[model samples]
Structures are given as structure tokens and as C-alpha cells.
Target: MYVAVKGGEQAIARSLELLAEARRGDVAVPALELAQIREQLRLGVARVMQEGSLYDEELAALAIRQAAGDMLEAIFLLRAYRTTLPRFGYSQPLDTTAMRVRRRVSGTFKDIPGGQVLGPTYDYTQRLLDFDARQPAQVACADAPLPANMPRVLDLLDAEALIEPIEPGNDPEPIDLTREPLTFPADRAARLQNLARGDEGFLLGMAYSTQRGYAESHPFAGEIRMGEVDVWVCPEELGFAIEIGSITLTECQMINQFQGGNGVPPQFTRGYGLAMGEGERKAMAMALVDRALRCDELAESNDAPAQNQEFVLSHSDSVEASGFVQHLKLPHYVDFQAELSLLRTLAARHHEDTDDTPLCKHGGARP
Candidate 1:
């Protein structure tokens, strides 16, 4: 039975009110302060900042709280907030080589210069859940002085002719993706920016696919560094670059073996990934997927799902994926009715044609 459905406005209003109430939680209990979230839920804040392409910790934390701890929704919230923000100016390419390294590691070499500093990593921790909500304990401060700066492991490789060298230059201005639509055949910078803001799960899945004989890319994690990098920009009037604050970044560079193809000799190839915060998994996954997407350029077989640029890049953002998938719950009655009418007509026509056909193939007698 078809009934005229109404009250969409009321439903939406109620939904909004419920969302607000849920986000706030019980009024009796103290509301979560932004600082508490930023400090305690650092990982969640980092994820939101990484995926949202915004480095503000406090804002990311607020988004997380508002989204009720939903990471993807938090990312969406941050992105929406980001759209309304005014861009002051572009920052110059960060000098990661001069990064104040907290954690740096290289997988390609057994030993490298500056040595491996596995600083503050959860990689080796047991997965057993801790059932205690212990109070924060203070640790004694170290009296010894810390290192002023640390060099990148990859720079040591560059010293030798083992790894391909990247030259420093004035990076061309980047187009704002929010302000402008993404176009096909994006440049390396553009692609990296897209991948950095992309959904972690989606990128991880694509990376996993490449390893499972999809793109057949033999990738090695050349280096993964997590630290604070200085952001600089040269205003035309200033005529020189100025440091515009620092941001924590996780950068991953994947080394791939490219056999002689596309007129290029057998050489070590590169796949790069950089995130706004400590997002090692996302960065590594992004590097693999980035290389997989470049199969055509390297003249590799492009039969894999990972190698399909359109498919990989298009579905990489959680915001877009979640919205479109959930949007089916919205109004679609017109389309549904059309489909229903077409199916009924097809069924009736098929039955009528069958009924008209004789039961016996030879002459026309009813059984």
C-alpha cells in the first residue's frame, strides 16, 4: 500500500537534536574539554588531522568530540571546518632533512648514518588490553642535554649513488582541492596531497592488494621518519623565505625495482607518502598504493585493481565514500517507483507470451 510520506523536516530536526545531545553526553557528567581530548586522545586527534589535511590539534580534538569519537566523521567535521578557514599563504616545501627527529628507521640498510632511533613507537607492544585506569604518573626529568638535530637515513643513501637523489627547487604553487575540483593526471605534489588526506583503511586495502600479486610491486620501506618539520614560505614582497611554525609529519619513501621499461634503464624507483602527523601505517600504505597507481607510467602491466588510478584515487576518501553509501537512505521514491513499474511490465509481458505459446510443440493441443 502506497501512502504519502511526510515529516522529513521534523525527522531531520529531531535527528539533529539527538546528534547534539549524544555528542554532548550526560549534562550531569562533566563535558570533555578540548585539551583533555587533545592530550589523552592524541592518536585520534592525529588521525583526524592527518585525514582532514589540517594540523590543528585542538580543532581536531573538538571534531573528534563532536563526532562522538567516530574517526571518519571527525575527519569530515575537520574538513568541513577547514573549508571555511581562510588561507593566509602557502608554506615552502618543508626541509625534512632538517627534521627534529623523534623516530627514524630504515628498512633497506642494515646500518646507516645517524643510527636507527626507534623512539616512542608502539610497534613492539603486546596487544593485551590494560584494565586499569591508573592516574597519570610523573617521571623524573633527564639532566643530560638532547641532540640539537638529526639527519635523515635516506640522506646517507644519497651520499652514495645507491638511491635516486631528489633536487631541491622552488615548488610550484599547489591548487586548493576544496576550492577547485580535482582533475585527471595530477602532478606528483597534487597526488601526494590527495593521498595524505585519503582514508587510511581504503589506502591500506589498496596497498594490501598490491602485495597480493595484484600490481606485483616489490616495494621496500626505504625510510620512514616521524618528527617535526619546519614550514616556510617566501612572500613575493618579502623576497626571502620565513619559518611559519612547525608541524609533526610522518614521511615514507618506498623503493621499488623498475626493470628496463618505458625507455628507462633498470633503476631504483620511488614512491612517496607524507602525512600531517604520526601516521606511519597510513604513510607506508600510501607509498605502496602511490607506486601501484603509477604502473602505466613505468610500463608495468596495469591489470590490477591497485593499478587503476581512477578506481584507487576515486574511492580513497572516506568522506565521499561514507556520504554516498549512506545517502541511499535519503529520498529515492521516484527512482524506486520507476524500477518497480518496469519490473512489473517485464514480468507481465513474459507471462503473456508464455501463455500464448502452445503446450505441445507439434500442433496446438492442450495437455
Candidate 2:
């Protein structure tokens, strides 16, 4: 349906030139280095990597710069670049229990095993901006190094047999969503994969809706940990796992009250979310929505929009949504002309029919 126009090739080229010039802005200003964006605007870089489904910080920074700091566009750029990459062996499942804890907190408990280690966060800071550029302040050092592996707060509840147990090893192998087209009645693994790369803003809104009585899962932020976790890969030839590298991650575990159904006893349920880099908000939002989507599996009411898997998964990709909505700006000349011709024909037919009829004083056409 999209026929290429013969003309305007030169104009498009000129427009692209203008776009490039505009992206550079004033030449007087120094160009932004990829390293600066990757380090200084780390959160933005993390969001790009998370949504783009790519973990290369340098590339993410480049995409961000190329997109002129447009987060969604940056995500799209990174994702587009990712499609051309060659497939390598998949990494082993991350072990969060062994994370080099930088930040760990829990709303369910005040004093968790590794008392709250509040890392660099904007939570307690004043919103006021300082006009003067200030030097970095010195950070106080901890008396003792943190334990190699901190015990998960959820484990305490698990010990009491209060929360549902997620036993490992029995679940089927998860499919690569990138290579496979998503189908209806998707399993939890697929759903989680979709959500992990979903637009953060969309997920946040859906999660907020759940709290506003839409799905009404009595959710508590059981634990949110941000740190670096080692990535391992096992090659077919080697038959042994090797540490490829480590990547920063944020993991959120949400506890929700569940009056068990489907022939199960009442027990607390859990919703999990994980993201690349320090993406606490994204992780938390994902967790809430994840729980809401589990309504069918948990035998709860699936009346809310958040519980609609089709709607959520379909609309979650910012790149796809942006393309579909923005494509209206494209040349629909043929389609528009057809519609206009049809309308004109209908109007002419009505006018011709009216010309042979007599109009009464009340403006009604007389037979």
C-alpha cells in the first residue's frame, strides 16, 4: 500500500542534512562524549539499554546522543542496531543472591539481614537545583565490608511457609521472544520477557492503576536490590560455565496478599521484576504489573485492563507504538486521494438526485 513517490528525493536528502545539522546544535558548544553520557547520565543510559534489550553502555550512550537525548528514540536506535548483531551463546541465569550489594532495601521489614545499604539515590535529596557548579563531596566509608552474599528478605517469610515457593528446575526452557512471534496464552516466562523490555512509563501507569483499585493486589515492596551480578556463559564445546562479565542490575520482589483459589490454600504470592543497571522504578513498576497479569494463574478476578495480556503486551513496546502512531505523518497520498474521490462522488450523486426534486417551504424534498 505504501507506494514510493517519484519526486522529493532531493528534498528528503536536504531534510536529512538539516536534521544532522540541527542535531549538532551550535558549533561553539563542545560535542558530548559517549563516555560522559554513559557515566554522568547513567540512569538515562540504563533506561535505553533496558528498553532497547541491549546491554552495551557505550552504544546506548551513542544512541542517546544521536537521538538528541530523546529516550524513546534512543531505545529505538539501540534496538534497531541490535537486530543486525550475530547470535552468540546465551548467558547463564543470573544469581542475585551473589550480587555485590550496592543498594538493598525492604518495605516489609525495617531491619533485614544486611541493614538497608542506601546507595546513590535521589530519594532523600532536596529537589532544589543549585545554580553554582559544586565539587563532589567525600563519602564516608563503612567500618566493615558487606557480606559476600546477603540473605534475601523473602527467605524469612519462606521459612515460615507464608509465601508461595518458586521451586526451580521443573519449568520449561524459555523461548527467545526476539526470534519468535508472541502468541496468545503466553506462559509466565514469555510475559516476563515482554515486560522486561516494555516501556517503563507504560508499565508505571499500569502498575499505578492496579494500586488505584483496578486490580487491587495488596502489594508490598518486599525487597528492592541494586548491584552488580556476574554473567556466565556455557559453550557447547567447553561444557563448563565461564564468567563472561558482570552487569549492573536492579531486582524487585513484590509480595501480594492472596486468598488462594483454584483448590489451593491461602498464602502470600510474589511478583518478580529485573532490569539492567540501576532501574529501581522500572523494576518496581514491572513487578506490580507482573502480579496483576498473574490473575488467571492465581485464580483471581481478571476484570482489569492490567490483567489483559493481549492489550498490555501489544502496546508495551514504545518503538512499535511510536512507529504506528507516527506513521500517519508519512505520505498517504494514494489512500487519501481514493477517499477524497469517493466522498466527492457521493456528494455529486446526492446533489444530482436533489436537482430533480422539489423542495417544500419546510425544506423537505417533495416526492
Candidate 3:
């Protein structure tokens, strides 16, 4: 086994130089500014912020630029930056009931308190390339006003006692996942936190598995809403909460059938998901995974991949996953050399065993 310690050092440095050159491309073209990424590629920035578990648009934009538009790397950069920040007092839980909703839809009901308002969604758009994006054009707005606050669809079911009622402060205090190591049989809060920061594609695949009969779940998008929700924080001296800021969020509430288990009457159960910014798909997938992981709570079978807490939470973080996968490209001379020597020893033993074995010279079958 050859170790290229000296040559590898020079090669890595040169590779970095080439990467910088490739990232910038020609000198004539203007470099992409942070503002451009923040405004033009706003969705990417939002996803980076959500997955990174940080809410700073400026920092997310800067990370996107620095990562050369690689989303996982941008998320990694944002997470790294967030770890260095001071830990201020924790904010009070956000009130989504008071959200200034921009889009609200319900698959379960056609007519709710607020009519279905499909605002800023690509659900019905034709999958065609826009040739006009090459040239700037003035976009016109149509005036169709919706109410500021729309009632949650699930609330309607709760009124009739058709769904479970979650009293405020009934559950245990949530564990701060970042500060503590994840253990088996995690609580709902820990699982949701991990899923919020989970890779979108991985969750999507896991969620899809349930639909394909990997697990038993029949879900309806009871309600999906996107809006700006106020964040509040209370200082010890103040003794009351004050609005700190407002951030865009997407909330998905999934309704699933609970077939009379755990000494509970047959009724509808809820799986909830909420994500920073307008990430409806991520929220939906998260809701499905959340429901799947709640087998024990529901007294259902936990014989599925999505139901396994260790399997899902352990591999959720994009930052950790990206680091581990990308680290393979780096030097592994010592590790490979050890494996090579082991393989040679095994081969020599196999050859000696073959030489020791007795062989019949006759081609015919033994009597």
C-alpha cells in the first residue's frame, strides 16, 4: 500500500484552487451577489434555512452563494454558523391559530370557515419551460382578497368530537434535541425536531413506502396552510410575552383512522407537521413519517422501517449525512492498506486449503 502524504497535500491545495476558479468561471461575468440569491433564489434559501434549523435569510443566502448552490453544503454551512451563536432565552411557542394566512386548503372538506384559497402554489401549473424568463416582463396582479385569519379545518372536526382534542400543556416538556444525544424510543417532540431538519428526499421516500403498504396508514390532507406566524419571547423580568418577529411557515395536519386501540373509542387521529418558510412538501412528508413513528402511542404494530426511531432519526440530518458521504473522497490510505493485508492473508489460506484437499482423477462419477 502506497501513502501519498506529501503529494496529497499539494494535490488538495491545487484542487481547491481549481474549485475556486471553476466557481467563479469567466472574469467578464458579474459575480453572484448575496442579495440576488436571497431574492431570486428565495425558495432555495428558505429550504436551506428550514433544514439548517436556522431562520436567518441573510446567512442562508450567504451560505448558498458560498456552497456554489449545493443545498446540503449550504445547510451544513448554516448549521456550522448557528453552533457559534450565543444561546439566548428560549422563545414561547408560536400561535398558528392567529396566523396571517396567505394560502389555506383542505382536502377533507370543500367548504370550511374559510373557502379554499390557493395562494402562491404550483399545484395546477403546467409543467412547461417558460421561454419568457429570458426576457424581463412586467407581471400583473389580480385582486382577489382573502381574510387575514382562516380557521383550521381540524378544529371543525374537534367541535363535533370526531377528532382527538389536544389540551395545551398536557404533554411533557419537549427535550432540546440539539443539546442532547438521541436515544431509543424518542418522544414526539424529538422526532419532529429531527424530521424538521431531515433531508427532504429521504423523508419523501420513507413516506412513500407507507402508501405502498410498507405500513398501514390511510391519510388525508386534512388541512395545509402557509402564512406568517408571529414569534414571541418573554424575558424573566418582563413576566409577559412580546412579539419578537414574524416568519413564514407551512403547516400540515394529517387525519388518519384509529381503529379502536389502547382502550380508546374508534375515532380519527392526527399527525401534525410544521416547517419554517413555505415548505409544503416537506411538511406533508414529515407528517406521514410522524404518523408512522407513532405506532406505540396508537398501540399499533411497529414492524416497519419508518416506525423505527433509531433508523429514521439517526440518518435524518443532511449535514451529518453529507459530511459522512463526502468524507469518503478524502485520503484513506491506512484503512485501505489494512484491508488489503487482511484480504491477502485470507487468499493465502484459501489456496493452502485447496492444495491439501484430495481430488479424484477420474472424470466419471464415483461408485
Better of 1 and 2 by TM-score: 2
Task: Single out the weakest 10-residue window by summed lDDT for candidate 1.
Answer: 1-10
lDDT of each residue in 1-367, candidate 2, tens digit only: 1234434776798899998999999999999999999998999999999999999999999999999999999999999999999998799889999999989999999988979888889899787896553766566887788778899999999999999997886889999999999998989999999999999999999999999999959899999999999999999999999998999999999999999777777889999999999899999999999999999888788999999999999999999999899999988988999999999999889989878666889999875
Clashing pairs in model 2? none
The residue-by-residue lDDT of candidate 3 on 164-183, one tens digit each, is 78898787888887788888
* Model 3 vs. true fold: TM: 0.93
What lDDT score is found at residue 295 in candidate 2?
A: 92
In candidate 1, stretches whose alpha carbon ends up further than 4 angstroms from where it belongs are: 1-6, 138-146, 170-174, 261-263, 356-367
Instruction: Please give the lDDT score for candidate 3.
Output: 0.88
Candidates ranked by TM-score:
3, 2, 1
**Tens digits of per-residue lDDT for model 1 on 25-136?**
8899998999999988887888899888789999999898888999998999998889898987777767887888878889988786766778768888787785653767
Residue 134's C-alpha lDDT in candidate 3?
84
- lDDT of all predictions: 0.83, 0.93, 0.88
